[model samples]
Target: MASRYHEVYQSWKHDPLGFWKTAAEEIDWVSTGEKVFDPDQGQYGRWYPDWECNTCYNCLDRHVEHGRPGQPALIYDSPITGRTASYTYSELLEEVEAMACVLADHGLVKGDRAIIYMPMIPQAVMAMLACARLGVIHSVVFGGFAANELATRIDDATPKSIIAASCGLEPGRVIAYKPLIDQAIDIARHKPDSCLVFQREELAADLKPGRDHDLGALQAEAVVAGRRIAPVPVKATDPLYILYTSGTTGQPKGVVRDNGGHMVALKWSMKYLYDIQPGEVFWAASDVGWVVGHSYICYAPLLHGCTTVVFEGKPVGTPDAGTFWRVISDHNVVSLFTAPTAFRAIRKEDPAGAFIQQYDLSQFRSLFLAGERADPETVNWAIDQLQVPVIDHWWQTETGWCIVGNPVGLGLLPVKPGSPTVPMPGYDVQVLDDAGHPLGANTLGNIVVQLPLPPGSFPTLWNADKRFFDAYLAEFPGYYKTADAGVIDDDGYLSIMARTDDIINVAGHRLSTGGMEEVLATHPDVAECAVIGIADKLKGQLPCGFVVLKAGVDRSHEEIEKELIKLVRDKIGPVAAFKIAITVDRLPKTRSGKILRGTMRQIADGETWKMPATIDDPAILDEITEALKTHGISV
Candidate 1:
């Protein structure tokens, strides 16, 4: 069976187009064409250029048409709101149809854009499907974003309408989103024609008369009026969604995903990479704003006729450290996917694994990690705790799906600690030098994808074609520059070292901060840690690390710092020059749990840096700055 998988991979490498044509047959398309890929039309390659289809129909209606109407489609688990709901295929189809009617009734036509800012609820999924059904492009912003961040996305997308909820229930509070939407509209230069609000009733929020309309009322009205909205067929190359990803600069880059190719590629990934079958539950603990949620949570699983869990709770919050375990056991989630940061948090709260052992995780088959590089410590911890194959995969927002992963469906490969295993079938991944030349195995360099990005990959930046070319394609003439620095071993397994910028040059030798961070994370007392390259007059750059200790660990700062320095020196080498290690209460991170190393570096270097809107806590920056100052570093 594993050989069969390898044979398929070899076939894809031999003939990419023919490989895709076979994959494209997995989904229902209105018009399938011979043209597989067109690289000349756009600087970035375009796949399934001459086909036409409606994504919502492929995801929702087809299952119903095939007599699987009672099959589960969406399993929503919102522990924060104390709500749990399930939607069958037929029920979801009807809801999506009604929502499409509501969109049409609001005067939203084909090619229009709608911005969705809602929590992880069924309505959010409905909004996305409704937009796709009507040939309207939807851009989903992370619900945790601030008003100013929301305004920036609004300005960039210039959406015709905004779909949002009045409030979302978090662990200790009911956060009103309607006010934020109103404030974002007030701040944004491009005003929407209308706003559709879902009143959660958890908090009070005033609704305007003419512009703001109730989402529930609109759906009810559509049903009462006997409005029948059919799926609007769009060309294969038509835009599906514009997902904005944060860049190194302040501006966010809107990545555009199209209809036909995206449907094919994602549908393929659900079966091959995730090993999820139809009717099985697949849970990805991520937000809709991120690409992982867009691919796995919303579209891919559904396209494969599987039940995708829309979880609206934290890994530790909605009660205790056993939240994820309870969710997995209660929902019977077969394949669990989440971030390493989440597991780290769980490990921090329950180091003895008592909470996890309380629940029966027999239904769980595999545990997948992404969103950041998974440290070997976290990977091993999860494997031991869960007693399952804990897999780490690497991908980006632009790619829209996993590029390198352990193919649990095909056959589980030998687990490599801190590596994302191997590339998937469609991708030809390589390590390239600064001059775009291929490097030998074990040599660290730029990770590039040889020409012709597979289907489901973003072809261009939304409304910024030249910028896309210059940012991604221009760096390597025929390959897509991933902007990640990494090494591929002789076994062809890739270990993503760090973002090229995160690679610190110390006396001209590149040192991976992620590598050192991974080593530091192995310490039993450490909860979370981040390493940043600080300016040094002697070696050009020096590694400075900040660690968050586990609760109840009463180790002194001096002792912990001394132990960490010696650990790094012994594990990595004396040449690593990892001298400074600071014990901090917490590392500054985003709501999604990515450490703000760049911001930390800025504060340490005394460079002017704006407090990012996505930061989870602003005070942590100040705390880090004060710690740096106390260490005799001139911040």
Candidate 2:
């Protein structure tokens, strides 16, 4: 089917407020006030500031009241514990009501902040919805974050209550969360009033006498009392949640998501952007800690009246590479959204996709990849294996939804292997040079979205409007600087090549490490790869590549390294000066699967650097350093 993306985009371009106001009606708004947008409200204006709504009501009660009470609303699948649970819309609303009553009984009120630190469980979703029910602004720090890192968020958000769990499970290990929460509370200057701890069967926690409360025990008590709390109405512009960006240092910065616009945008995305409809099973196989989990996993699916999966397992090693397929097949999932790193991992384990054949994916319609630039090799590999339209979309934590994507429902545009397709309805994406001048089609330049960034994007940093302006808006004047370097083709497809910092200069020529990584991915034996610009005395900077080979590849590493160097030189030209390809076990990545390229560059240049708070494993950096040492390039 041919896409009407151009028609819809033009409509949005012609009248942004009218487009959003029409979309806003899809949600069950408490009061759809007159002003669709107020341009003078914040750093770059505000969306639906006067509109009043309850995010929790749209996600839960509305579906139940509209004769869909028996439909499944949330599914909890935990391969680690071999446990599965499903909740109907009515059942989920009951649980959220009980939890909200518990919170209200403990004196949590509208606008008071709460922090949720829990694993991927039914309780975590309940906590978030319950907070939303009472208009408490909640912040979710990823389960198992370091004590000091959690402390930084505790100081920043300064929640009055904390909802957490005892432990989080990995394939071969159990991460104790209670101790980390305790330690964070100890380190932070601001102390939360109470801590609600959920005890997993694998590991129980020791609750503090005065302040700590058992979550299960309190929730049971609330249910016994028949406490049913109604969803509190809040101004559309009032904050729904605060999500601290994953890869950060020093002081933690929290991006605030507004209740009204967040509901309007995500609900619209479910039908138009994702093309999944009501009552279908939609699974975003991401942890609730990140933005993907917040929007797709927790909020969007529920708002759209779809059953959302809360998966507690890895892409592999939870059982095997077949776990993902099993979950999709078992749940009758129609759409699956995950990061590209997951597919690469599965591809590395089962290159032939033999595990995929063991399950029936007749109901699965499409696969969406994000969280990083989806290299063409990985994208093509997924297309071949799944025989589904593998879409590569791009967005960020601040935006809360897609900036550039293929509107699968509006009808997908022609697939471009590397580009994320094009800017979505709300974004006016452009490529601009250093001086803030617009660049022509297909020119490598800074990617900026012309402000005011549509509904659902963060308006400002929590409690730091000046810092938000300085960090995002001040640099580009009227545009919100994405800080990513990319090219928009003549057809308007946006190709995210790298972060602005990742664009390196070789002699006098600007080059993209992402472009080189794409070339390296084409190598048959390379399972995963990363490219960084290393400092060089003669050329100012030289390209350095690292690769991890596929399983059962018996070819010599030296031979593959030589091929990779030639592949980049041939594909990107000699101006890249591509040299130094090293074979490593893995590339350093954040917990969310973003390669730590900037950190790798810092190490190669012998610059002092602190350990990233979001590093997947601190030990990976040691492996990277040793691999660099072999190539005579180390700090």
Candidate 1 global CA lDDT score: 0.89
Q: Rate the local accuracy (lDDT) of all candidates.
A: 0.89, 0.93
Task: Give per-residue CA lDDT, model 1, range 184-300, as digits (tens).
Answer: 999999999999988776865688999999998889777677677889989889999999986535789999999998999898888888888888999999988788889989999
Off by over 4 Å in 1: 1-3, 224-226
Which residue pairs show collisions in model 2? Answer: none
Q: Give lDDT tens digits, candidate 2, residues 1-635.
A: 88999999999999999999999989888887778999999988999978889999999999998989999999999999999999999999998999998889778999999999999999999999999999999999999999999998999998999999999998889999999999999999999999999888999999999899988888988888888998999999999999998654467789999999999999999999999989999999998999999999999999999999999999989899999999999999999999999998999999999999999999999999999999999999999999999999999999999999999999988999999999998999999999999999989999999999999999999999998999999889989999999999988889999999889999999999899999999999988988888899999999899898998999888988998888888988988999899999888988888889889988888888889988889999999888888888757
Q: Highest lDDT, which number?
A: 2
Per-prediction TM-score, please?
0.98, 0.99
